[model samples]
Target: MADVILYRWSTERDTWVSASEVEEARAYLARQGITTSALPDGRFALAGESARAFGAERLVFLGLQQLRGTRSA
Candidate 1:
């Protein structure tokens, strides 16, 4: 099974948003003027207080399945 990493955004009006891709999350961070540095471990390190102010966290989505064929009933 493969795992996917996603970003969870802060709640708003009892609702929340998540970024499904790295670029998507980076775009949002960039808009907030939050800089991210690449770590030697292939992970990102958020810069400054934006980390706390952003209120976003990394989440792991596991056991994702992509069905390739239609089911026969």
Candidate 2:
């Protein structure tokens, strides 16, 4: 299956954190010899055994962005 990259906009930091969870996952995968590539615009590409090992995954993808005075999740 094709790799899916999730995205989320951080209101606290006020920036796009692409594949945010992937980074954390990569750390563990790295120990097992997995390779990950961070793409432009906060995206990530994962390959090798790590991808297969950490294959089944779920992501928040993105939270709503609220205008000043507006609320979003």
Candidate 3:
């Protein structure tokens, strides 16, 4: 399966936070062994394992997208 890109909602900003804005949270997730990558469009992504492990309430499901060029086997 392909990785899924995720966006986090920011109550303070009242919108979805950009990739750069998610760095702090990304770092925290990294410590827990859930690696995420920054996207060119100012979003972040998680692989299959990481995605399954991530359960942050701030994550915006509306913006969740599966990366292109990958298919489930």
Candidate 4:
């Protein structure tokens, strides 16, 4: 399964607020009239007023992949 995560960059705190659920992220984006597109790297990109509406400087989509043939530290 793909581990999809959404993050909004907070300029004030210089950090990010994340949503683990794809549905939640989709709803939030829809409310803000934002749209997402799939990238070639298997990640998503946000467009439109998401940053301003959410009081964030940027919005990012993160797709987590497990490292195969690697030992967990």
What lDDT does the true structure give each of the candidates? 0.37, 0.36, 0.41, 0.38
lDDT of model number 4: 0.38
For 1-73, candidate 2 gives per-residue lDDT tens digits of: 0122222233343333335444555554455454555545444455642342222132122111111113322
Among all windows of ten consecutive residues in candidate 3, which has the lowest summed lDDT? 62-71
Cα displacement (angstroms), candidate 1, residue 58, comes to 1.0
In candidate 2, what residue range of length 10 has the lowest lDDT sum? 60-69
State TM-scores per candidate. Answer: 0.37, 0.33, 0.40, 0.31
- Write candidate 4's Cα lDDT for 1-73 as tens digits: 1221212223353344344444445555555555765445444556752343221213323212121112243
Task: List clashing residue pairs in candidate 1.
Answer: none
Error of 2 at 46 (Å): 2.1
Query: What ranking of all candidate models by lDDT puts the best one first?
Result: 3, 4, 1, 2
Error of 3 at 8 (Å): 14
Model 1 deviation from native, Cα RMSD in Å: 13.1
Residue 7's lDDT within candidate 4 is 24
Candidate 1 Cα errors over 4 Å, as ranges: 1-20, 49-73
Predicted structure with the largest TM-score when compared to the true one: 3
lDDT of model 2, residue 48: 45
- Candidate 3 — number of clashing residue pairs? 0
Angstrom error at residue 15, model 3? 4.4
Off by over 4 Å in 2: 1-21, 47-73
Candidate 1 lDDT tens digits, 1-73: 1112312222232223243444455554555565665555545666763343222234111011111111221
